[model samples]
Target chain A: MADTTTGQSLGAERTTEIQDAYMAMTRTKRMYGGIMLIVFIALMVSGFMLADSRNAGGFWDGILNIFNFPGEVLKEAGEKITLLPALMVKFFPSLVETINIAAASTLIGGLLAIVLSLLSTRGLARFPRLIGVFRRLMDILRAIPEIVVALVLIFVLGGGPVPAMIAIALHTAGALGKLFSEINENASLKPLEGLESTGATWSQRMLLGVVPQVAPNWLSYALLRFEINIRASAILGFVGSGGIGYDLKNAFSWGQGRYDEVAAIFILLFLTIVFFDQLSSHYRNKLVGKA
Target chain B: MTATAETLPITDLKQSATALIGRKRLLAFATPVVIAAYFVYLFFAFDIPGLVDRARMDNAAILVADSYSYKTHVTHDNRGGGLGFAIEGENKGTYPEGMLPEFVTRTGEDAVDIALKAGESATIEGSTLRYTRPDYGTVTVAVEGRDIILDTPDGTVPDWISASGARVNITGAGGRAVVTRARTEVYRYSMGWELFWFTLDSPFYGKSFGELAGLAFSGERVVADKSNLAAMVHDFWNNAMWRHKDVIWAIFETVLMAFLGTMGAALIALPLAFLAARNFTRLMSVRFAVRRFFDFVRGVDGLIWTIILSRAFGPGPMTGALAILITDSGSFGKMFSEALENVDDKQIEGVTSTGAKPLQRYRFGVIPQVTPVFLSQILYYLESNTRSATVIGAITGGGIGLLLTQAIITQKDWEEVSYYIVLVILMVIAMDWFSGWLRGKLIGRSE
Candidate 1:
């Protein structure tokens, strides 16, 4: 009876010790979390201050006047609301050019991305030793902001839609290549092995066996990229390439009397983005859901 | 009875299969046809033919050449009767008196001999300039009374030599020489960026690598006030031609924008996600409103948001950050809420069974499950936002993008443009590696 009581007490003491250690760990973790939070807060505050000091206008002053430009634009647009439709019609072709740039880039970029992804993918790579080279190439291609390419091309090719198209296409290829390779990794190798056993060429195997498996995901990604490219192409246009964004910039620079045109372009952009955003999301949902 | 039922289902499947094949065939042919037609239309619309005519191959050649090479200008002022040597003929790049490159030698009081590449040589004597090329005989140019006279060995100039009553230009494989009534100049092209590490004024400007190493290790101070290494660093950092200090600051500012933007967006989106999540907010109206708000924000797009926020915050890193923050918040909100909805109910149930409060339950159960997903998304955006920040910086007149645009705008600073491009590429790749590393550390590597 005495030995049993002592053993029970010893077990009880060990359990209490473990409980104390767990509580201590929890407290230490909370302390670290608190410290991290404080540090993050400090960084944000200081960064904001530094940015404010470097700015042309103070944040507080600018915020107060923030609505001034937009309000003026809205007022003018409201007054000339009748002209808005005609302005939209005038800029519609430019908008079409922007869309075309996006579509063309997506098509071209998607094609290149397919080749690049296959080249970089482990089992699918034709020259596996050069996979690092291809991967780095894609990284560089993706790293280059479209504006950099567009601006440089503008210098070489002159201001036009082609520069923007090429820039967006190059970026899309790199961006999509990375994502596509990820999908390619998950693809079942059974079909690939079967095709290879039948003496199928690499391209044939990829086309017949692998492409079917990943097509849906690739298409879905390409559609999403198209939506993104549209926005990118528009922005590139603002930087001096040709599109509705260029028209918007012209109208914006004119100020006051041209607010109607700006408003029209803004409406078109907003509506188009929303429409494509919804459409792509809906299709992506169906595609992923079915899979 | 079983056979009939099975046959009926098999017939249905066969019919559907045939129909699907037919549709697929139609789509296969129609899609390409449509795409081809669109391309044909685009070819005309974009004016592919006219682009060829509009393209300036000469400008492209100059850009390509200038990006990798620099020229030293040797000039004799006809009016002032003075000799000047400069790199790219810029005032900042002018050599000090009595200081000249090795290729140029002062032969006499009023004469200098320039040793061009490939056995080509040029001599400047008072008002006369003579160039000798191995492939071509000597050509003499004289500036006299508001006119340039060119005397070739054959009395007939080749296509590479362009002469007018007022000016003469001799272009050869080795170098170029131009003589006008006002001045006579010879340009010697050489490989590599000129004075990249050190300028002419620095004590270590033209030192060999071995010498530099020795100086860095044990030599006396290069400057009177500082150590040799410090002086070297100071000179490199303050290099007037490259502006390394400014470039580094700009890079930092770009990263700052991305960090502030991504973190701020995540912080804002986390709470807003709860309101939009169907499982979290019991009120349907609140959820609908928040979801719609996210859609609206996302629809406006980053470009519009940038414009709007720049108006409010003015041009700087802060404006770019805010634009990124506002736009990405919508994305994060939608993604976060979806993640929230997909959370396993058992974890939350266990926490609730412990008599934990709602906040405690979320903190202990929901946050942990979603943290990895949230972190991965945030880090991915942080990488991409670096690139966006560059573009946004271009629009806002800040960061390396501004420097790049400015350099390109100058139309002659292709070297600087190339430099900026290299730096920007390196910055982006670094960010990519960094974010990937962080993601791997935070969440186990996927591959």
Candidate 2:
């Protein structure tokens, strides 16, 4: 009975020791986390101050006046609300041009992306030795911002939708190529081997064997890209290209009397973007779910 | 009866299969045909043939040539009767008096001989300029009174030479010379970026690499106030032509915008995500409102946000950061809520069983479970936002984008444009590599 009592005591002491060690560990961890949090907060504060100092207007001053421009715009838009419909109608052709730019670029870029993805994917490349070359080409294309290309092209070709289209298409090709190649890597290669055994050409094999399996995912990605391209096209137009954004810039730059036009454009752009966003998400969910 | 039923089902199956195959084949052909038709329509819509005429090939040629090569201008001011030599004819690139490039030799007080490539040499003396081409012999251009006269060995100006009474421009394989009544200018083209490290004012300018290395390591003070190495670095950093310091700062500002924007978005989105997540928030009204807010923010778009913020902030990196933050918060909110909804409940249950309070449960259970997903998404967005920040910067007037646009708008600064483009590309690639590395380090290599 004494020995049993002693054993129980010994077990209790060990449990207390273990608990103390665990508590110490937890304390150390919490202290480390606290220090990290403090450092992060410090970094964020300093960074914010630095950015604020570099800005043209002070943040505190700017914040107070944040609503001034919007208020003026809203007041003007409200007074000339009757002209909104007419302005929208006038900008409809510009909107169509913007959409066409997006659509054409998406289509062309999608096609190029397909070829690039196929050429760069491992175990499926038509020229295995050139896989790295194609991959690097995609990287370079992806790294270049669309504005750089658009501005350069605008210089040579003058300001137009074509420059925006070509610029967006090049970027999309690179962006989509990387994603498509990843999807290609996940696709089954057995069908490709079977096609090759049947003496099918490289293109024939890709079409008959590999493309069917990856088409749904590719289509989904392409749809998403189309939505992004629309935004890019509009932004490019603002920079100096032909589209609704150019009209909006003109209206906005006019400052006061043309706020109605700006308001109408903002409405149109907002609606179009939301519509495409919803449509593409719906299609993407359906594609991925069904697949 | 069994055999008949089986045969009937087989025939039905075969018919359906054949129909499916026929539809597939038709689609296969129709898709490409539709695309081709659209391309044909676009060809006319974009006016491809008209573009051929409208396109400025000379501007493109100049852009390409200027990006790779720089020209030295040897000019004599006829009105002032003084000679000056400058690189690219810019005041900043003017050579100091009595100091000239090896190719240029001062023969007299107002005369200098410029050695061009391919055995071509040009001597500018007062108002008269003489160019000697190995194959074309000698061409003399004199600016006398109001009329500029040009005389070639053949007495007939070739197509390469465009001469008028006021201005005479002679273009040759070696170099180009322009003689006007006000000034006679000779351009000698050279390869590579000149004065990239030091300007004419610096003593270290035009030093050979070996000499520079020797000076750097010898611990001598080239400039009185500073050591040779320090002076070299200071000169390089403050290079007026390259603007390296400003360029670096711009790059940093670009990255800072991305960093602040992405992290700020993630922080703001996290709490909002809890409200939006179906499993976390039981109130339907709250969830609906939050989701709609996310949609509204996203639908407004970054370009619109950038414009709005720039109006308020008056054009800076902060406005860009805010624009990115607002747009990305919408995206992060949606993605984070989805990730939260997908979190396994088992961990939460275990934490609850440990007698952990609600806040502790979340800290120990929910956050740890979703951290990897959160981190990976945030990192990915960080990389993408770097690119977006460049675009936004252009609109808001900050960062390297501002410099790039400024350079491009000048139309003559194609070299600077190319330089900025290369830097932007390198910055993006570096960001990509950094994000990938962080993703691997923080979340392991899932791929």
Candidate 3:
């Protein structure tokens, strides 16, 4: 009876020690969390103040006038509602050019991405030693913003769809290459090993064995990239190239008198973006779901 | 199924199998053919053949060469009767009085001798400029009256030398010389960026790295009020030609735009996502309305948002940030709702069983369950928004993109353009690494 009582007391003492340690750890964690939250809030507040100071119009002032431009646009566009169709129709070719830029770049970039991803994949690379080189190349390609390339190319090639296409394509290749390589890593190596045993070349193995397994995922990613590239192409056009975005820019800068044209371009752009977003998402869901 | 197939005709199965294979094979062949045909159509549509005609090879050459090298102008005004030395013919890069490039020597009161690479020499005497090529002998150009005259060693201008009545231009491998009625100029091409560290006015300009290091620690003051290192840094930061301070500020503003936009979007979208999530909200109308709002904002796209916001906020990083915030809130709303819907109801039920209130239950159950997903999405967007911020900055007129556009617009600032490109790339890579690190720290690496 005496020994049992002593053992119970000892166990209680140990429990108390553990509870104290747990409380200390929890306190430290809470302190860290609080500190982090304070830091984050401070950063956000200061950043806002800095941005506000640098802005040509202060946030409070701008917020009140936020709806002014849109209201004017809508009113003017409403006044010329009958001309909306003609305006959209007139800009349709430019819209098509924008789509073409996106599509062609996606096609070209997707193809290049396939080759790059294949070459960079560990077990599937033709020259395994050069995988790092290919990866770094993709990183660089990805790091460069499309606008930089488009602007530079505009200097060389003059303003057109070609520069925009090339710029978007280069970016797409880098982006898709990274995603595709990730997909490649998850693929079963058994197929590759079997193909190797069958005396298949690297290209043949990749095409016959790996491509079959990853094609759907790759296609889905490419489709998503295509959606992104469409927006990118339009933006590039607005910057200097040729497309609906260029038309939008012209209409937008023309100000009040051309608000109808601006609204028409806006509608066209919005519709196209929505259409592609839905279509690509639908296809992507199917592809990923089937897989 | 095999038994039924066996009960059926074997030839019928074989025919069906053959047809299936044929169709698959045809699809395999047709896909590439269709792609090729589309490309061919695109070639015509994009005017690929005419692109060659439209392409300016000379401009390309100038861009490539000018990006890596700079030329020093040794100019003499015929009427003004004075020699001036400037880098790239820019007023800011003008050499101080009594100062000249190391390769230039004052031969007379109004003349100088320029020694170029490979035993090439040019001497300016009064209004005449004489350029001596190693093997081709000396070519002289003199501005006499309104008409400029060129005299080659052989008394005939070669293909490289283009002489008109009003001007004479002699292009040589070493340098280029042009004689006009108003002035005569000689351009000496050299490798590397000039005045990159310090402008022409700085006392520390043209100091070697070792010499700079020595001076930095030697207790010597380049300027009266500051130490050598401080003075050096001040000069480098305030470099007029490169504008390093402005460039750095631009980069900081870009990152600020991205950070503010991404975090602000996440903050705005969180509550809306709960309304849209099927598991969280009971009313269908609320969910539908929230979801449609998300779609509308997303479908309007960043370009449209940038345009509208710029009009309201004017040209600055604030506009770019707001544009990013508006566009990404839509994306975050959709993604967060999906994530919220995927959360396990058991956790919420467990919290409620503990006699927790609705807010307490959500805090304990829902937030924890979706925090990881929300964090991952926000971090991913943070990195991407940096790139978008650059593009938006271009449209909104702020950040490094604005600087880049301005530089490019100048057409002569290719070197600055190249510098900005490098810095932009580095900034992006740094952001990528940082976001990745933060993601790993917060949620652990998914891969």
Candidate 4:
């Protein structure tokens, strides 16, 4: 009976602490919480209405047909072959081409970004206004989807992989430029200052001091973006840009009984992503000297 | 590498000028070259016009009219030989020539049983056989040209008759010919157990991914090449009907959907974040729980959230929106909470100590301090979500990406496909600007 009473007292004490904390809250906080709650409720309700997941099968099936159409074309190609061997085949040729295009864009974009970062960072601290502009520009660049960019460009440049690659590369440059600049800015400033004190030129100082510090981070970021590029390539493939995404789309679009094949390709893609992640993590750890 | 004043100060100055000239040369030559090179490559990388010609010749026009005349191809998945009759010419699709013919085909074959019309040729073989005009539906000859226009029963439309029957040979542009035969092929097989992941990661990878794949799977195809893959790309670039347009639409719609959805996520996240911050809230426990919940939502990827939304709503803008909302909830929640927590408490005290009501105190003290950060984070996410929207669209089948995939597979029109790719990148840029403007308005109060 005494133990039970003690337990009850402990529970009571806990409640008292909670209430004390609650009571201790300044009126400013309660008011904020109440208002925030109301806003939260409204958003949640509206979002529920907007994103409700009750009727998505038809849409999914429709898209599945589009993305996996390449697979369907290949299968319907009437190449008599062993089932197991065919199942293990990788991306259709066109999809592979898409990946190539996306990769090319990434390379071109990253290369350009290196230069942009140099200019942006050099001007950023000296002119705080430039920082705002640079930052805003990047935000704007990233806000628009690549697909939309492709559509507009299609009207201008005609349809093909070149416009797609240009769009992908441009966005890549924008994104990478910002990330590289941040790394440079966050890098150790002591070396650059030391070089400056030695009467080293600005370019010399940046090359000898700044570049070394940020190189590892840049490489890490680059590697990460490569993975993203692959996914982006798949996206481009959907738009007839060329790649395996179309194959996946075809596989999904045909009929209901072929989900197993769709699942297989999906698995391969997932595995590819996982493998890249593992490889990247390995390199990142080695670079950082993680034990 | 060193120039000295002893020889001549003027000379030294000139030498230094030369060094500057070298640097300028490096910048002037490289900068424009790089940008110009990119533009050049974007303009004439491969035969962009050839893709159009090919598409025009052997049209695989989408089923925009619910029915199409498909010239069967005998080519393998690699545009090689398959079992079906390769349409000898552009007698495959349902489009009119010089007027968007209801059907058009390049080299694929048709096996339709048709009643011969007077002075018309039945597209059966490779040569346009001469026929005498007998009557409205009497005389007929099978012709094999780059295109074969057949007079079907439905107002003399172009239709392929080899549904599961005879095969046709194609001879044109050598590689552009498609084989026509009844096809029951399924996509090439991929190893299973690769996609069963339940973790969060945004790490990078090196080229050693193959070693890992080989390790993970027992029966791995080392060389997955042209046979199954190439045909897909070719179809996507060259096919018009539904291939290019559909994927483009998917991508376009995805961008719009994501932009709208991110807006919703931010609207929900901002004020709640302030409340969730202990420094800004009256209830500590509520703040902690709400913050944790937000974290949980943010913990999952937008793709997973897409699946969840698909379950909640039919696949459309709703599913895509839900996915964006769930992912952005966590992002906005954390950003807003941090902004709220960082606000100067002195201001809050200044307002409240004067016996001001809770609402007035919050309005005067807290909102202003955090609005800038809130707006900036929202903008950044809006930009980021544009890319993320691609994935959401993929999950829901409501974006240009859907058509994009089809185009890549069926038409192989790489040039047109490139345009879609460009569109997405541009959209990301536009979002970046709008968000920045919003941030400036809320905080910097600058132009």
Q: Report the lDDT tens digits of candidate 4 across residue range B366-446.
A: 877776666677677776776777656655666655544444444433333445555655655656567677677546764
Best-fitting candidate, measured by TM-score? 3
The number of the candidate with the highest lDDT is 3
- Candidate 1 iRMSD in angstroms: 1.2
Look at candidate 2 and give me any clashing residue pairs.
none
lDDT of 3 by residue, B314-364 (tens): 999899999999999999999999999889999999999999999999999
Residue-level error in angstroms, candidate 1, position B172: 1.1
Task: Provide TM-scores for the models.
Answer: 0.96, 0.96, 0.98, 0.45
Higher-lDDT candidate of 1 and 4: 1
lDDT of each: 0.91, 0.91, 0.93, 0.55
Could you give the fnat of all candidates in order?
0.68, 0.69, 0.75, 0.19
Query: Could you give candidate 1's per-residue lDDT for residues A1-291 as a string of tens digits?
Result: 999999999999999999999999999989988998899899999988987787777878987887888888899999999998998899999999999999999999998999999999999999999999999999889999999899988988988899999999999999999999999998999999999999999999999888989989999999999999999998899878999889988987787798888889999999999999989889998887754
lDDT (C-alpha) at residue B163 in model 1: 92
After superposition, candidate 2 runs with Cα above 4 Å error:
A1-28, B1-7
